[model samples]
Target chain A: MRAELFLQYLVSGLIYGSIYAAVAIGFNIIYNATGIINFAQGEFAMLGGMIASSLASRLPLALAMAAAVAATTLVGIGMERAFLRRIARGGVLKMIIATIGLSIAIREIALLIWGESVRTLPFFSGTEVSSVGIAGAHFSPQVFWVLGVTALVVAALTAFFKLTLIGKAMRGCSANREGASLCGIDPDLMVTLAFGLSAAIGAIAGCAVAPLTQTHYAIGTGLGIKGFTVAAFGGLGNSLAAVGAGLILGMLESFSIIVVPEAYKDVVSIVVLLAVLFAKPSGIFGSRAAGALKDY
Target chain B: MLKARNLEAGYGPLRVLKGLSLHVAPGEIVAIIGANGAGKSTLLGSLAGLVRPTSGSVTLRGEDVTGSRPERMLAAGCSLVPEGRKLFAPMTVRENLELGGYSVRRRLGRKAFEEDLAGVFELFPRLGERQGQLAGTMSGGEQQMLAIGRSLMSRPELIMLDEPSMGLAPLVIKQIFSAISALRSRGKTVLVVEQNAKAILKIASRGYVMETGSLVLEGTGQELLANRDVQRAYLGKEYSSIADEREGR
Candidate 1:
């Protein structure tokens, strides 16, 4: 690729990374709050794409996203209460299998309802090819929205966890469930809250990326795995690191396509994940977040 | 006052506490001494709502609290420092303390919360010094102190500690014990389960001995410490010979 093409791809990849960052951070929330990683996370994101796409065509642009987020939040809460909570508290292995089962059920249900065919993902903003000249290159408005949304979500989450009482209680559960209980904080309720919060975040990400990629029921599996990779890449519980690591993964995956065939894009991401696992085991930013996650 | 009546509790099918009964009066310290699996921790767990009692009642100031959730227990003037120093490891010492005060009772007003924080800091000045330090990074003694101090943040009428001196220096144990005494002096009721019997007995106003999930002995500190059987079996045989003579070893 020429220098200009390379720069453009790099920027586009960063934007894609922002989407991953949003989804990956969802995994981080539940992983931190409870030791269980909700494998059904991607379904919530997919719901975002579907709901937002349907509503965006009719409702005010922002309200459509809100409705989508609210719906996914309830899905997340139902998934936790109806299924995940019971088996998860038993053992780590049981929890893992339970989440996997939940994922399969979610995917099948989505397939039954939405069908297997890919559907269009509507953009949140007007799809006019708005451009900006930066130094000598132009960037798309869509890419800028992706970056802006990720930043806003990150900022909001940081504030919630740091400042609010319920947020602090959630953090208390993440760091030390028993200790939090001793302090009059209900770990179980907090775990449930974490799932809802994560679902909303995942839905927001789905809404953000829906216009770029078509929606499909089976898409949850790959997206779920990718979200897990981003969580692991940043360490299990750290939100900011998940964001940073996600963008990095996205950029690498997108840029890799220039050298290898597009068919190998998925393989490149998996390979990089393995490399990170082998190199840091904890992740690139794993140690930094490790402190927050030790109790779980 | 706090009381447990015929409390029966266990995990799955294994019953750890079998009809155990005990009571602690206001402004008093009660030490519960037992062997490792004598259901010492189990009894505390039941009291803290970490375990469900199959048949029994826990009452604080005449309120039936059996199966009351941990958060409710805290709001009702009952706080427990669990077996391990379960500090929010990633959180700063101040954050840990702040969370400790998460109770409806503590939400009375700003002045009350501030008063509680001040009281906790006064109890463990070391925690005050290391308020900004991460809990997981602190030393065993410091963490133990923080655990106690964190529990104190709730300003409960009854503070129950499970093995506060489990893994600490003799000096640290002394500090923790003295703090317990000071707490009593301030009219707080305290219940402690400990393998560190000698020190626990020394500070406790009264003591109960448990053997295999049953309450075997109950007396004032001096009475139990002075009993030859109690001294040899639990209080450690130096003060009396009945335990040694009975052993025949």
Candidate 2:
């Protein structure tokens, strides 16, 4: 029975952790390209969840999820083209302020569209799907979906950056923008593409976790903060590090319930975030150069 | 052929190139020698479209390409090797070369790209051997060769090199100069900006001396090498003037 309890907490923590890692990956994509923190990142995920939930009521689950992710990706590209790219050369402070404003605007739009009510999405494989047992504890198949999706996304991203010509150019820009520009790769286009891909990743996470977490106009605020914390914890610009940090964070949150009241989980998380940041300002796996939040 | 007429450009309020004009005809090696901060790199940069001239016109093969963006300039067949041999250090040498040929590869097919890659490898056999090696791990001379080799991957009509001799030893500089001469033999128009005046003059067909954001003198390599002012400022006091071999005297 004790072993079952341990497995439940551990497996559940890892599932939640993978979700956080997905969000962190979103933050990393734009950050790597432009060194912008992209405070609007969480909103992409929020939009994904809310949009998918609403669409699933009328459309098939697969199609709805696809549309939601695609719509969110377009929104991400629009954000870059309509605003971020215009102000890209205007220094980091300006970009930060602009993204904060955009985040607030997006949140308000969400509130207007979805209203204040929390909404639920139907389980992708259905709620009645049998759960696998570990000792006496049961683990849902949804957990596997989340973990599997995260692995697939990671694999896809690695190949995209390594194998594709456009992806290689994006990496070249990230490594040295001037060198990339000289090679006839436009930095602006690469940045816009980065935001689009980032949004798609965020939306995938949002859609994946919506059935588990439920969606609300206000859920983004907490998730955004947590994702940012994970990104910082991993050391900004290092996407792989972000995953490790997110997993550790999710596990820490899950295990903390053993000592603290479940209601105090948010407080525990905030405390841990502060403690980890104070101890290693660069996060656990961040290199000294990447420790600085913005390269510019 | 490339031509710059009365180019004036600079950063913010500080002007660097004040009415600087020069040209590199087809298949010629033109060297610009100047002291540090005299705007040698800026001149090359402006020509390469990395820096926009406040007022001037740049003509590449008789097409007015003034104030064009670097990517457009590169696509139009001009490439700058840039100062400091800035290789994408973490990437492999082949990756660097591929990126160098990005515009050409996009325009021409992969077959043309492969052929260009073969030519670049032929020029620098050492680079071919270390195609998979991380560029950052290479020696300074190897990096310079890779930088030049990378530029050659573009198969550019006019190739501008900035400070290729900045950090290399004598033997490496000799090898680099030989490569520059070899580039001329292959009909690539070359513009070299260097602080190593004496060495650069040896292979350059024509040369210019820049001082305080302006070209103070323009002459054939032999003439500039014999100029008293150039000798005093750049080439040491030991350089004997070629005055006795003066053409029209």
Candidate 3:
């Protein structure tokens, strides 16, 4: 590829990578706190995208995104209360089965409600060329949204964990369930709260990125797999590490067009995942057990 | 004050506390001494609402509290420092205490919580010093101190400690036993279960001997210490468990 083409790819990869980072952060939170990979996370994203698309048809861009995220968050809360609460005590086997079943069920419901056709977000930025270079590599407002929102999510999540009592309680529950109970924390409450928080974040990412990739009901499986792979490649239950890994994966996928075909980009992330499993088993920046997120 | 009458409790199908009965007066130190698997821990678990009793009642201050949720009981002024010194290992000593006092702190204003925090620190100076140190990284003795201190944070009217001296050095055990006694002097009631019968009786105002889910003996600390049957069974070789068995003959 020529220099201009390479620069374009670089810019595109960096922007896409930022969106992946936000999604990975949400995955890490649920995985760390509940010891279960909520496969429906991508569905949350898809829901956000769909909701944003429908709302933006009439409402302002920012307001549409907000409403979409709020609606998806409520869906997450309902899923936790309806599905997770009953099956939490169903042990590892039953809970795993329940979540897997719920994932399929959610995907089907999305397809039924939103239809199987892909839907794109409306033009958030007017048709304006905002570029300084002679090549006119204009920056779209969608690209800016993806980059800025990812940074904000990371900062907000970090602060919540550090400064809040409820956040500490969630951490405590994740570390040791029996001991947390002894400390007077209700483990069930913590688990439900975590699910709710993770879902909301997933929705935000979905809504933010919809204007670019659009969303379809059947899109959940591929996105869900990518989110999990990104999370696992980084560190199964490490939020910061997951975000970093997601960005790296995103860049790999976007940049592979130069060295090889676009398909080869995913190969980098997959290889990293295998290497971590074979060598460290915990990925970078994670402990052996990574059992931090299992109980509450 | 606390009372357990006809307290029949068990883990699942197997009964552990078979019609066991005991009581403690206000500002009293009562020790329950028994052999391993003597249902001592089970009794405490039932009292703490960690285990459900098959039958019988546990009353605190003449109020029926059998099978109450642990958190509700904790807020109602009943706290248990469970076996194995179950502190949040990843958390610091202060975090552990904060969790202990979580329910209590909800009712008190910020200032009162701070004062109570200081009071616990006064009782266990090491906890104050190690506030930022992870509970898991602390030595066995220090963890034990933090466990007791954590229970104190709840400001429970009745503190039930399960084997506080387990796995600790001899010196540490002495310090812990002394601290239990000090709680009584502070007008707080304490119920401790221990295998060290001799040391327990020394500090307790009254004592009960449990064996395989039954209360075998109960009396003043001095009386039980002198009984012959108790001498043969527990109290070790250093002191006879009991002087005689006064069975109805």
Candidate 4:
């Protein structure tokens, strides 16, 4: 492949990977806090994009984006408050099933509201498909938005987890819930906050990518599956590794086009996931028992 | 300072604590010692509000705190250094100490919180030396100290320790008991529930023995130490000899 084409594929791959990273981060948050893979995570993104697309037509763009994020955050908090909280004391297996049920409910609700058509979000920067030339390769300004948003969110979350009291409390709970509880930190409240934060992050991912992939009710399932694969590949609890694994997955999918047909992109992703599961089930950076969430 | 009245609690259809009652006055070091499956830990869990009681009440400093959840119990001036020192293993010791003051920080502000941290560091200077180390990576002795120090960070008027000497060396167990003894001087009431009756009863102002979920015996530390039945059941020949020497006979 020519350098320009190679670079173009690489840029788009980074954009896609950034979106996947945000989604996987959402997975990591809920999984770390509650020890359950939130199957409804991807739907939060889809809901955010769908909400933004519809609201943008009536309201100003920024307001629509804010509303979309706020609404999705409530949905995330609601998932924890209404369902997960009730079954939280149950086994992790039960909570996983609950999330699966929640995912279906959320997707169907979006379908009823948005109809079956794909929706578009106006680019945050401009209407024109403007490109920025880096070296010999050209990329859209939305590429920058996707990458920038992902970077900003990741940095902010890193700071929050490391520096803030509540954030540290959340980490403490994830490490040992009984220990955290003894310290007067309510693990349930931390888990609920995790749900809210994860939802907002997923929504942000959807909003960033809507201008590129377009928004649709069915968009979440595919992305959710891929995002989950990324999370598993990075080792479930680690956030930085999840993003790194996401980028690598995106690159693999993008570069495989050189050898295989473009229609078989998901085939490449599936193959990679299988290889990771077989060779290193804990993901590249995860501890051997990374997937094990202890009920403390 | 702390009281549990007719407490009944258990796990899923198998009750462990059966109508047990206990009390600790202010500035006292009290120990509850029992054999395995005697519900010693359950009694502490009931007192700390970690396990909800089927009946009866837990009160700290005159306020009923029965079944009030662990956080509320801590808020009500009671802290539990749980069994096995359930520290946040991945976090730094400093973080563990800070989290111990979670409710304290919220209610007492940073200045008081920091003072409490200083007090803990003073109590266990080793924790001060290894503030940045992971709690799990520390030695068993250090971990026990950190657990006790963490509980102290809450600045609770009453501190309850569940099996603080469970897996520690003899010297470490001695150090822990001495620390418990010092708490009485520092104006903090302590409740230590342990299987290591000999060591705990050494520092305890008063002691209770539990058997199959009920308080089988209660008396002053010396009285219990002198009780032949207590000596045969919980204390061995070595401890009995030491008690006899201390009594000058």
Q: In DockQ terms, which candidate is top?
A: 1
| Candidate 1 local lDDT, B20-74, one digit each (tens) | 8999999889999988999998899899888889998999999999998888888
Higher TM-score: candidate 2 or 4? 4
In the range B153-236, model 4's lDDT, one tens digit per residue, is 888889999998888899998898888888888999998898888777778899999999999899988889777778878887
Candidate 3: C-alpha lDDT: 0.79
Listed in order, each prediction's TM-score against the native is: 0.93, 0.94, 0.91, 0.96
Best by TM-score: 4
Write one digit per residue (lDDT tens) for candidate 2, span A1-296: 38888888898788878888888888888887998888898899899999999999899998999999999999999999999888978987899789989999999999999899998778777483578776888877777888888889988998998887788888778877888888888989999999999999999998888877888987777788788888888877777888888889899888888999889877766886798779987778976633331224
Lowest summed lDDT across 10 adjacent residues in model 2 chain A is found at A287-296
DockQ (CA atoms), all models = 0.68, 0.50, 0.42, 0.64
Clashing pairs in 1: none
Model 2 CA lDDT for position A173 = 83
Better candidate by DockQ, 1 or 2 = 1
Q: After superposition, how far is residue A222 of candidate 4 from its true place, in Å?
A: 0.7
Interface RMSD of each: 1.4, 3.4, 3.0, 2.3
Give a tens-digit lDDT track for model 2, residues B125-234.
99999999987778999999998887887778999999999888999999999999999998898999999999999899999999999999999999998788888789
State the lDDT of candidate 3 residue by residue for B1-249, as single tens digits: 899999998866788899988999998889899999999999999998888888999999998999987876786788888998777787778887877777667678566667878988888898999899988778999998898888888888899999999999999999899888888877789999998888888888999999899988888889877776666678554332122234422
Which pairs clash in the backbone of model 4?
A: none
lDDT tens digits, residues A1-296, model 3? 67777767776877767766666777777766778778788788888888888888799978988898888888877887898778777775666567778778988888788887888886556533443342646556767777788888988988887556677777777777766676677878888788778878888888777767778887666677778777877777778887777777777788777678876766766776677778876666666433442333
